[model samples]
Target: MASHVGERMSGSIGVNILLYSFYALSYAIPGGIILIHSLGGGLLDMMFSMPMSRMQESEADYIGLMLMAEACYDPREAVGFWQRMEAAARRQGEEVPELMSTHPSNQHRIEKIQSWLPHALEKFQTSDCQGTSAFADAFRRALERGTQFQTIYM
Candidate 1:
C-alpha cells in the first residue's frame, strides 16, 4: 500500500506540474497576443480567458480521475475529495462565482465525476488483475481511516 500510494502520489505531483505548466503557457500565449497587438486587453481579456482556464481545469480533473482509476484507486473517491475541497474553501471564505473562477465549482466537479463514473468503473472492472493485493487493501484501509478522521474532525 505504501509503495502504491507513494508511486501514485509521485506520479500525481509530476502530472499536476505538467498540467499547470500547460495552463500557464496557455494563458501566456493569449496575454502575449493581446499585448503585442495592443488589443486593449483588460477585464474583457480576462473574461474571455476564464472559459479556457475552466476548461483546462476540467480536463485536468478528468485526466487525474482516469489516472487514479487506472492505478486501482476508486475514482468515486474523487467526488469526496472535491467535496472536501469545497468545504475547505468555504471555511477559508474563498467562495467565488463559477464563471469568475478558474476552476469549476465543486458542485460542477462532483457532477462531472458522477457523469464519468460509469466509464471509470468499467475500466476498473475490466482490468486484468484478478484479485486485490495486500498493498491495495492497506491503501483502502488507510483511505477509510482518513475519511473517518475527516468526518469526525472536519
Candidate 2:
C-alpha cells in the first residue's frame, strides 16, 4: 500500500515536473556517464534491499509454519516442502547465490524450519483440532508415493 501511494505521488503533475526539470538539467551528461551512474545506483539499491527482502521472506516462512501448525496441520511438512523446492530448483538450474537473491536458499529455509519445528509441533499438539483431515491423509499418501506435492495444490 505504501508503495502504491508512492507510485501515485511520483506520477502526480508536481512530481513529474520536478523530475523532468532534473532530467533537463542532466541532459548534457555523457551517455556513458549516465549509464554508469544508473548501474551503480541499481547495484546499491539491490545491495540494501535484497537482504531485507530475504529476511522478510524467512520471517514469513516461520510465521506461516507456526500458523499452519496452530491450525492443526503437521509442521514437518514444511521441511519437506523446502526439500521438494530445492530439488525442483536444482533440476531447473534456478538456484542463485544467497547474497544476490531476494530469498534464502531452499536448504537454508529447510534448516530454519527444522529448527522451529519442535515449537510448532507443540502448538499443533496442544490445539483442539484433530490431525487427520482428508487433505492431511492425502498429503501423507503422496509423500509415501514420492509424488511432488506441487502437482497437488489445494
Candidate 3:
C-alpha cells in the first residue's frame, strides 16, 4: 500500500513538473518576442505582447485543468476557483478589458473552463481513481472556506 501510494505521488510530481515546464516555455516564447521587439521597453511592444501573453495564460489554464482532471480531481471545482479569482480581481479593482490584459478576463476564463468541462468530466469518469481523496477533500474544504471569506469580505 505504501509503495502504491509512493508511486502515485511520484507520478503526480512528474506530471506537475511537466505541466510547469510547459507553462514556463509557453511564457518564455512570447516574453522573448516582446523583449526582442521592445529592445528594452515601449508601448507598441506591450500592445503586441498582451495578446500573446493572454493566449499563453488561457492555454496554461486549459492544460492545468486537463492535468488536474487526468489526475482524477473534480474539474468542476475549477469554476468556483475562477469565480473566486474574478471576485478578488473585482474587489482589488484589477479587472481590465480582455484584450488589454496579459490574462484572459475572468468571464472568458469561466466560459472556457465551462466549455472544456464535459471532456474533463469524461476523463474523470473513466479514470480508475474512485471519488475524492482525503487531500483533495481537504483542499476543497479550504477552497470553500476561502470562497466564503471572499463572499463575506468582498
Candidate 4:
C-alpha cells in the first residue's frame, strides 16, 4: 500500500508537470497536434506505470508472506489462497496479460511464493510458534516432507 501511495504521488506530480507544459504549449501548438501528443504521452505513461504497479503488488505479496511466516502463521496458506483466486478467475473467464495489467497474474504470484517458501519456513520454524498451534505441526510435517511447492489448503 505504501508503494502504491508513493507511485500514485509520483504519477500525480508527473501529470501536473505535463498539464502545466500542455497549458503553456497550447497557444503555440495546434489543437490537433496537442491532442496527438497527449494521447501518445498517456500511452507511454501506461506502458511504464503498469509494470511498476505490478512490481509493487509483487513486493507487497512477498512482504506479506514474510510477515506471516515471521508471525508463525503458515506461509503455505498464501499459495492456497492464490490458487483459489486463480480458480475463481478461471471460472469467471477473466484473463489479462501481465504486461497490460496493474497486478501480477495469480499463477505468477503462486510461483513466487513457492520460490520464497524456504526462507519463510525457516523464519516460521525459528519464531516463537513452536508447539503453539496446529499450524506448527503442519509446518514440521511439511519440512519433513520437503517444503517446496506444497500447498496447504485452509
Candidate 5:
C-alpha cells in the first residue's frame, strides 16, 4: 500500500514537471532566443518581443487571479506577492535586468488583485483540495493561450 502511494506521488510529480516544461516552451517559441537560450536573444525579440511578452504577463496575472478564484485559491495573495515583487525589482535597479517583465507596476497589480479578493476569499472558504490544483489548471489555460502564430504580440 505504501509503495502504491509512492508510485502515485512520483507520477504526479512527473506530470507537474512535464506541464511546466511544455508551458515554458510554448511561451519561448514566439518569444525567440531570449525565451529559450538565456545567452542568445535575437535583436528584434529583445527590442520588441520582450515588452509584448510583459503585457501578456500582466494580462495573464489578472486572468490567473480570476481562475484561481474560480478554482478556489485565496487570490488575495496576488496583492501581497506583486507588491513584494515590485519592491524587489526596485531594489534590483537595473543591476541585472530582466528578459521580459510581463508584470505591471506592483501597485497596479495589487489594486487589480485586491479587486478580486472578496470573491476569491469566498471561494476559498468553500472549496476542497487546498486550491493548488486550481492554480495548475489556470497555468494550463494560460499556456493554451500561447502559440506559434499570434495576436497582440505586445
Candidate 6:
C-alpha cells in the first residue's frame, strides 16, 4: 500500500514540501548511497564467494538426493527441478533474484546433476537395501539443509 508519507517522500520532492522534508532527505540520500554501496560491496563479495557457494550448492544437491532417497522419494527429481529452475531463470531475463542466486546457473549445474546420478543411486541402494549408513550418509548429514534444494529434474 502506498501511504501518504511514502508517496510524498518517494519521488523528487521540492524544498517547500514540508518541515519533515529535510529530515526525509537527510535520511533518504544517505540511505540511497548506502544501498548503492551495499550492492557494489555484495558484488565484490560474490566475486570471491560465488565459486565456493557453487561448490556448496553442488554438495547440497548431492546430499539432498541422499536425504530424498532415504526418505523414500526418488532422487531423480533433482534434474527436473533444476530444469524448471533454468527455464524460470530464462523467463526472468536480466532481473534475476540476488539472494536466491548463490551458485552457478542451472544450465551449468544440470550436467553435474546427471553425472552424479549413478553414484547417488548406488548410495541409495546400499543404504536402503543394506540398512547401513552408506557412503552418502556423511554427505547427507553435512548437507543439513539439503531438504530445500530444488532439483533440476523431477
Candidate 6 structure quality by residue, lDDT tens digits, 69-127: 67655568889998998888788784344444666677767888788888777766656
Write down the TM-score of every candidate.
0.60, 0.64, 0.57, 0.69, 0.40, 0.48
Q: What's the best-to-worst order under TM-score?
A: 4, 2, 1, 3, 6, 5
Off by over 4 Å in 5: 1-55, 70-72, 95-102, 129-154
Q: 105 in model 2: Cα distance from truth in Å?
A: 0.9
Instruction: Report, for every candidate in turn, its global Cα lDDT versus the true structure.
Output: 0.72, 0.75, 0.74, 0.81, 0.62, 0.61
* Per-residue lDDT of candidate 3, residues 6-105 (tens digit): 5445545655565455555556685755454444324432454555567667777888888888898889999999999999999999888876677889
**Any idea how many clashes model 6 has?**
14
Candidate 2's TM-score reads: 0.64
Ten-residue region with minimum lDDT total, candidate 3 = 36-45
Which residues of candidate 3, in runs, are more than 4 Å off? Answer: 1-43, 131-154
- Which regions of candidate 1 are displaced past 4 Å? 1-40, 129-132, 138-154
Off by over 4 Å in 4: 1-3, 11-34, 134-154
Model 5, span 40-107: residue lDDT tens: 33543455545555556556776777677667556777777877888897898832345544345567
- How does candidate 5 score on lDDT? 0.62
TM-score-better candidate, 3 vs 6 = 3
**Model 5 root-mean-square deviation:** 20.9
Global lDDT of model 1: 0.72
Q: Which candidate model has the greater TM-score, 4 or 5?
A: 4
Can you write out model 2's per-residue Cα lDDT over 30-139, one digit (the tens) per residue? 67457545664456436655666777788788889889988888899988888999999999999999888878989999999999999999999888775457677888
